[model samples]
Target: MIILRTPRLTAHLAVAALFGSSLLLASCADADTTSNTSSVSSSASDSPTSPVSDSSAEGTGAGNGGTDSGASMLPSGSSSSADEAGQGVGGNASETEEAPKTSDEAVSEAVNRVNRDYPNKFGGWVFKGDTNFDSAADLTYAKVEQAQQGNAQYETLLIFFHKGEYLGIDSTYPQQVVSTAPSSRGLEVVYKDWEALRDSGDANAAAGKYTSTVTYYWDGAQVQHEGRIPNTGL
Candidate 1:
């Protein structure tokens, strides 16, 4: 019982040393393998799939981002429906038609037509001469220049025809006289041809012997005429 077992103790110590060394080597190998594996994974992630590539990562990124594709596509049918509703089928129809003539143009055309139809039928009647009781006196067709100045505002033509010739003619005397008069006169020249008396009266008025003038007018036409009484003061 008191004797020492040195060989047995030595064998036990050697077995423990071997076991510790194996454990350290195994741990170191495990660490190295883990680091190498991590590096290899990072390298694989960085490498491009196509080796001689003109292709870019930016293009791939844009495809993945999804915004570019949406922008390139055409609008839907519902958008077209909205545009059609806003425009309506009748739009611009009125603009395609011709505009009508103006009022001024129409009026000018009417005046032209009247002038063409009634071209100065009473031209070359003597306008000025002394009054005579006989039928041979110079009768004139003068315009009414001023109603108060013994002048006519319309184409009031003077005539020397016998009173009977004008009076008996239908649509001649009364019509012409009334149409010519600016205002009705009392005790108007009844029997004699009234033109002589009226003309004399107008001459007297122009000489300042009277306060008013007498004139004549033509009743039926678009055009007008006027006559000026000669001044006796000149």
Candidate 2:
């Protein structure tokens, strides 16, 4: 603390001195208050409100999960695996859709299927019938001489016809026809003309009984042998 003093001791002088001291003390108090106010103002100006914000960190993807920009959110390799699986599915779908049914495949299925509507006709040459055979040859038969049986001679003329892919045999039975040629057993079926046989069967059924010499014609072939197999593997 600082104090201001005077040497005079008179009443008048003391009064004057006290007043002067009072003014000096007031001036000093005012100066001290002004200094404190200036200091506070300076401190306030130098340390103005500086509210630091973390907004930049939030904008850099830190608020979400601190992930890098434009980075994938899925687990490692998940995207690639999903794409491969999708492509595989698409390939399978395309194979199933683009595949076509072929005639050979259909024929294979048809070959195994039972044809209930086969041979619409009873006595005729049918292709791929119940009993169908294929071969390439011209079959013939020679007249048997002096072959007599049951008051009838086995002497007849045979005609051969080339009906495109099949051979037609024609014969006439003008007399009584025997069920089995007793003299002609163990014959060889070297060739087959099924077309003529089929026609002959129907023709015999139509002609009840041959009372006199008659003629029979077959639109197929004659039996040259019995059970004569050739090149079975072929």
The per-prediction CA RMSD against the true structure, in angstroms, equals 39.6, 41.7
Q: Candidate 2, residues 1-234: lDDT per residue as tens digits?
A: 975454544666989899999999999999999999999999877753423222211111101121222111111110110111122322431212223324333222323221221111223221222111212222222221223333232222222211112222222222122221212232122222223434457553434332222112221322222221211122
Worst 10-residue lDDT window for candidate 1 reads 74-83
Q: Please report how far candidate 2 places residue 18 from its true position, in Å.
A: 0.8
Report the C-alpha displacement of residue 108, candidate 1, in angstroms.
Answer: 72
Give me the runs in candidate 1 sitting further than 4 Å from their true place.
1-6, 48-234
List the lowest-lDDT window of 10 residues for candidate 2: 72-81
- Deviating ranges (above 4 Å) for candidate 2: 1-10, 49-234
